[model samples]
Every structure is written in structure tokens, then in C-alpha cells.
Target: MNQPASAIEILDTTLRDGEQTHGVSFSPAEKTNIGKALLERVRVDRIEVASARVSRGEIEAVSGIIDWARGAGLADRVEVLGFVDHGKSVDWILKSGGRVINLLAKGSEKHCRHQLGKTLGEHLNDLRANIELAREKGLAVNLYLEDWSNGYRDSRGFVYRLMDGLADTGVGHFMLPDTLGVMTPEQVTAAMTDMIRRFPHLKFDFHPHNDYGLATANVIAAVQAGAAAVHCTINCLGERAGNASLAEVAVNLRDQLGLNPRIDETHLVQVGELVEHFSGKRTAHNAPIVGEDVFTQTAGIHADGDHKASLYHTRLSPERFARSRRYALGKLAGKASLLKNLERLDISLSEENQHKVLQRVIELGDSKKAITSDDLPFIIAEVLEGKDYTHVELLSCTVTSSLDLQSTASIRVRLQDEVLTAAGSGNGGFDAFTGALAKILKKKGLALPRLVDFEVRIPKGGRSDALTECIITWACETGEVRTRGVHYNQVFAAINATLRVLNLQIQGSLQQSRSIDPTA
Candidate 1:
């Protein structure tokens, strides 16, 4: 039988170290919201909310959090970062009703010599005095050995000397930070094991940064080396690269390491979305666990493997994190992927029709176009219409726009060769086009859905002919749906997306009415 992995505690520091990211600052209200969400929703074991005496705003933010945590009866679980400054930091912590402080201390001799201009003995004495003062002031202290990794590498003897001096200072924990994020997993294991051997009685916490994109890996190493807690931030928000990401760390610890953390995996993506919105930093589409495309398989072979036996997947299933796997259609899509896409759209194609549609889809994909499920009917209508079936078609559209000039669009559409044209004008060309479309639909006694949202994405590598992808969402009496369009011009993309939505709506209404009364 295999031995089970050890459990490690999680200490999230998004509000403190994470806020240190350049050009990122959370308002007091924002900090309070994030604190509540992290504690009550995400359920990390502890949260380092802020630093002491940073600013009046920070003080208020920590104070508010302390009040909230107190009401929730979790006051002790909240912590604040402080420094050894003759009890000034202690005073700030006490004033803010913060009971726990991660006291900042020099871990390396160079920091002591250059930053404080103090000898090893002098620094130890100062720390002792500060610890005694903190104890007298009723503050629980956790020592942060700033730059401890560098200390272990450069001056191991001095590092041990400082730890030995403060070993019995009634400190609650020793937080070893990779302050410069320079340690590899091997180094972390070696240094952490040495520290554990030297101070067997002291509880150790590990804080890692992401300057090298190895913070999560280092966190795992720390746990393996017997760290009691590891610090993380939501979305890896911190100075420079970032700190270890909470979602990645939590899931990895649970699934890969077989460690149990009291985190609700289902809420991981929701929390990431909330933070991304509040921080005004959009999460990249490819971000692991919480990105739009992480669960979407775009390659046909991968989709086929997934359909067969989930052969292309890892242990991280999308459903485990409240997400569903998606099959994307493009040049890379195979027959299995196309069948899956058709299944999602509730459309059945004959063997011959499937090949024709697949060919067209591949041709479009070769041009770097993205086809959505809503585009299936239009493709079928164009390919199979008049030959094997009668279907709806857009006959012609006239659009005009000029600055301070009358913008107009006249559209003529044909349903089984019955033609209808409508004209309208508005402030912009697309707007006028939509107005004319609505007019035509109303005159033909067709009910049009309302457009709820519109978004345009301009591809990178700017050029006049660069492809623009437009997505539109529509809401109707029956339901809501989304459609995507691509074109060289932004306006053209929008127009295409709008037309797709309209086309889908017409097809859906026709099918529903036919289903209600087949003879009619």
C-alpha cells in the first residue's frame, strides 16, 4: 500500500504581497470584499491581509477586515505584516485590532549590515526587545526572515545564529520567504530540510514569489519538506511576476500531492473572475484552471480522444472546477469533433451533407476563421439549399455611412424565393443596418430577438487588414444564444455577427412553429 501525502496549511497573502504588483492598488472596500470572499468562499486556512503602518487607507482596510473577521468569529485567522521598529508596527497592529503580526526581520547579514547598519548581536538584541514589546502589547508574532533563502545560500552560519537567538522568543511561527524568488525546488528542499533539522520545535511557513514562474513548484517542495503553511495570492497577483497562484496551488496540492486543503474547488473559477474584474486585469484566455480556453479543446484529435476515452486529458478534469469541456471547430477539427459539435447544436446531418459541411468548415478555418455552433444552420442553408432543400437566404444588403451625412441600409431577404426589402437610417452604418433588418422582420410578421451584448476583439500585430473577431449575445422570449463573426474590418465583423444571430433566430422560430403544427 502507498503512504498518503501529508496535509499543509494555506495562508493567502493576495491583499498584502499581491497588491505589491506594479500599478495595482486595492481600495479599502475592494480589500474588504476580497478578504470576505477568500475567507468565507474560497476558505483558505489563513489570510495575510495587509502590512502595518503602510498608509491611512491600509489601516482602515485592515481595521474593516478585522471587524468582519471578529463578527465571523475568525479573528485569529486574519494576520497583518509588520516590522521590528521599536513597537511602532505593533502599535499600528493593535490600533487596527489585528491580533497576529508577521514580524519582518533581517534574514541575511548583508541586510543587517547595509539596511540597518547593525551587527549580528545588535540585530538579535533589537529583535528581542521588539518581541518582548509585542508580547507586552498582547500581539501574537510570526517572524518573517526577509531574504532567508539568500541567507541560507550566502551566510548559513549567520542565518543559524539569528534563528538560534530568536528561537525562544514566544514567536508563533517562522515564515521563510524567498524574497527575491531565486531558489529552485532543489535549493528549497535542501534549505528547508536544514532549517527543520536545526529548529525542530519551531513551526515553519513558506512564502514564495513568481519571478521565475516556479513559485507553485517551490510551494510543493516546501510542503514535501514539512512546511506547515504556504502563502499564495489570487491569480498570482504580486510584485514583478507574482506570488504563487491560489487556484493552481490549491488544486495541485489536492490532486497531485494528495493533500487536503479546505478549499471549495467549484468556486475557484468564480473567485478568479471576481478578482480579475475588481483588479481591472483581464485573465488571459489560456490561464490554467480559470481561463476561457483551458477547458476548450480546439484540436480535432484531442476532441476525438476525449470522446473515445478521455485519453487526452490529465487528472485535472474540467468538471472538477465547475467547468465543462468544449469542442472547438476549425481546420483542426476532425469528423469526431464535427459530430460532437453537431450534437451540441441538436442538428443531425446525413452522411453526404456532413462531408460537404466539413469541407466548407475546413476551408473557412484555413482562412483563420472561428465557427460557432450557431453558424451551423447558415452553412447548411448555403450548401444544401436549392439542391436538396429549400431554405432561407440573405439576398442583398445596401449599407451607406458618412460623417455628418445620412447613414442608411436597405436589406432584401428571401425565404423560399419570397423577397422582402426594408430601408432605415441611424447614427451609424451598422445601427442603420440593424434598424432596417428589424423593419423588414416586423413587416414580415417575424419576431426579432433583442441584442443584449456586443464585444469586438482586434487581433495583435496591427494592420489595416488584420482580422477582427466580434461576438454578440441575444435574448429572446424563448431563450438566449451567442454567435461569433470574423472579418478584416471591425464593422464588418459586427455586421456578420448580427446577421448570424438574425439567421439563427429565423431558423429556430420556423422549427418551433413547425414542431407545434406539422401540417401548417
Candidate 2:
């Protein structure tokens, strides 16, 4: 293998090729904003904003991008895809104020024979004419050997003939594309080495697709094989499985190949978000570098290892991308996981309270699936205030509600020594549950206190299955008392809060009776 270059130029084609993604079309304004962010913030070396003669909107978009790029002294860095229709594509690009055109030509004999029905010599003549026209119009040219991977493999002579025909056309870069994403790393290494060795004076850029999920790997192979630059798209947006992800390509080029790319690490996720929003396509949560959960530790053992010795840490730290590490709270949570989150929130808990809180987290996780650090305070508050009382136990309860119909509830509860069943109807599920509890209390010559206030909340950015926290305040004869509960179901959260109140009220009444008469 040939030695890698010191640096590589990244040409982000998200706006042009990425728009080919299914159901994705960016408005001119959206394209302008993304182009600005990619060049100004993310600092990519080049951007391909549109294809020549696609639409009036594309012309407007390219004009906007080119205008801004020129003012920023980066006009030549912005490119537009152009076809080989003599001077038509060159004129379209000129009308859009574009200074660079990536001229597309067939690389394979099959494509030239079947798609265009022209010989390689005829195709070369058309390409030379287009290149001459572009140069005359003061536009730099880059030729895309479309499907060069298959071309090199099947008909090396056709590829050599095409190259020999245009070797002196003054095309700045010959971009080689794995258009169908069929080449393995070994194949890429061999072909890129051959292309570089044969055409030692020419610069090459590798454009890869992800149909086989090897775009990033193939990029490594190409870069190591002495390619000068590479082509990629943001969030891997493109036709079919999409192009190589810009984030993965940039990072791997730097870390795996020891080459520098003009990319601001912090702004990677920022641009990824911009494309993800404009394209209306959601990236995978586990996508490298820019994924939502890439930096999160869900395993208790991993958190523990990191806390003790940074054992589970890697160079791919979240801080590198302007994100923080989070220790997930769930059934897998251990004391170390709880401690890590507590330390993040700057909270100090005694060992006993910490144990209690950890247990509550595990119990809640059984239904909530995952709990974020934002939910930690709720669990702490609930566990700290709850008493170890066996005065009342909720055995089984069922609450049902329907549209335009009164809700109904049936409950079996054990109060001190008696197990009683009661049924009631009310306005909603929680209201019906309270009505049933009230019936059982009425039989014991007791009444529930007046409800002063009730509040419910979930963690920030919480999913639908996140834990629900319910806090209820009741007014008794003495004063107001508050109780809190955490559960996956809002109704059950309220019921748990109510049970705490009942336990407190029963304890208070018993204490008063003992004070009034020693042996009644």
C-alpha cells in the first residue's frame, strides 16, 4: 500500500446527492442555511450544493450559496454537479454563479455502451468539449468517473482509454465512485493504488455509497492507498442506503489513518442536526459520532469502571463533540451508577439514603425501561419521605375509562387487619380509584382529608415510557401534608401518593386515641 497524504479535502455533497434520499427535498432557504453552516461552522473544505439545470429552485439555491461563499472568500470551494451535454451544463452552472463544476462521465464500458450508446472515443470527445467550455467560462473542472470501481474491475482498458484521452484536459480532480458500493476494502486498496501509481501526477477523490455498509471502511482503504480527497454526505443521506457519513469519514481518516481533515469536531453534530431537520430523515440513535445515545453508559459495570479508573473510556469521548457523558438509571443500575449521577447533580446522600434511592430506581425501571438523571431527584424525594409502614396495602385494583362514559374502579385493600373490596364510579380513572378508596374508608367511620393540590411531571426530553412523578398535598385537621410517588403509570403514581397520605392519617389518629385514653 502507498503512504497516506498529510491532509485530505472533504467535499460534502449533502445538498446535491443527499437530496436524492427518499422523500427529502430542501427548499432554497433551507439549502442556503445548511450550506452556510457546513462551510462557516463545520469548516469543510468544499461543498456541492446542487446539480446543473435541475430546476429554477436549484438555480436559486446555488446562487444563494455561491453569493455567500464568494463574500466569504471561498467561492471556488463551492461546487455544482454538471452533465456532459457539450456547453449546456457549463451555461447552467454559470447562470447560478457557480465557479466549479463536477462533470459526470461514464467510467464503465457497459454504461457507455448501454446507457449512452456511445463508444469511449466519442464520450472522450464530448468530455473534452465540455471541459474546454467550462474553462473558457472561468469555471474549474472536476471529472467524476461514475462507477469507476466496476469499470476498473471489468474493463480496465476502457478506463485507461478514457483517462489517456483526457489526461491533459486540465481537469483538477478525477473523482472515482463506488457508485453501487460493491467494492471491499481490499478491492479499494488495490484499485486506488493502481490508479495512483499509473496516473502519479493526477489527483483523485473517492466517492462511495453504503449499499453494503462499507463506505466508511472503503474510504479508509482509499485514503491509505494515496487518494488526495474523499466525497461524503451529512447523516449519510443519499439514494438507497445513502452515501458515506461525513462524520464517520472525517473521524476515521484522522484517527485510523493519521491524516488531518478540515473539520471542526464540535460543529459536526451541529451540522448533522441541520441536515437531519431539513431532510426530514432521522438518523439512527447509535450512528457514530453524532448519535443521540453514543455517549451514554447504560451498563452499571461500565460506569463503575470509568468512575474508578477510567477503564471503559476511549478516545471517542463525548467532550470531544461538545456532549457530556451520562450514566443511565435503570434496573441495571448499581451503587456506582447512582453515585455517578448524584455527583453530576452535586447532591450528597448518606449511604442509607443512597441505598434506598438505588432500590427505588431499580423498581421503577422494571416498568419505565430507562430513567434519565433528570428523574433522579423525583425518586430521591419520594424515597426519603416514605415511611416503613404496613398499616395499609393495595392488593389489587382495576380502573377503566371510555370516551363519553363514567370511569369505574374496583379495588381490594388490606387495612390493618381487614381485607375489604369496594367499587365506585367517577369522572376519570384516578377519580374512580379515589371514590372506591373513600367507600372502604367510610365503612371504618373515617373520611379522607381535603385535597389541596396535585402535580405531575416527567423528566426533560423524556419519552412516552418515561417515569411519571406525582406529588399530592392534602389538608388535614392539623395542617397540610405532602406525599410523593414515582411510577410508569400516572394513575398508579397518584394511587401510591394517596396510600402514603392514608398511612400518615391513620398513624396520626391512632396516636391521638392513645393520648386520650391509656386503656380504652
Best by TM-score: 1
What is candidate 1's lDDT per residue for 373-466, written digit by digit as tens? 6666667777787232233456777788898897998888775558878898998877887787777777677755788878888778777767
Q: What overall lDDT goes with each candidate model?
A: 0.85, 0.89
Runs in model 1 deviating more than 4 A are: 1-6, 386-454, 463-465, 473-480, 487-492
Clashing pairs in 2: none
Using lDDT as the measure, which candidate wins? 2
Candidate 2 segments exceeding 4 Å error: 1-5, 387-520
Per-candidate count of clashing residue pairs (backbone under 3 Å): 0, 0
Question: Tens-digit lDDT track for model 2 on 89-171?
Answer: 89999988889999999999999999999998899999999999899989999999998999999999999989999999999
Judge candidate 1 at residue 508 and give its lDDT.
71
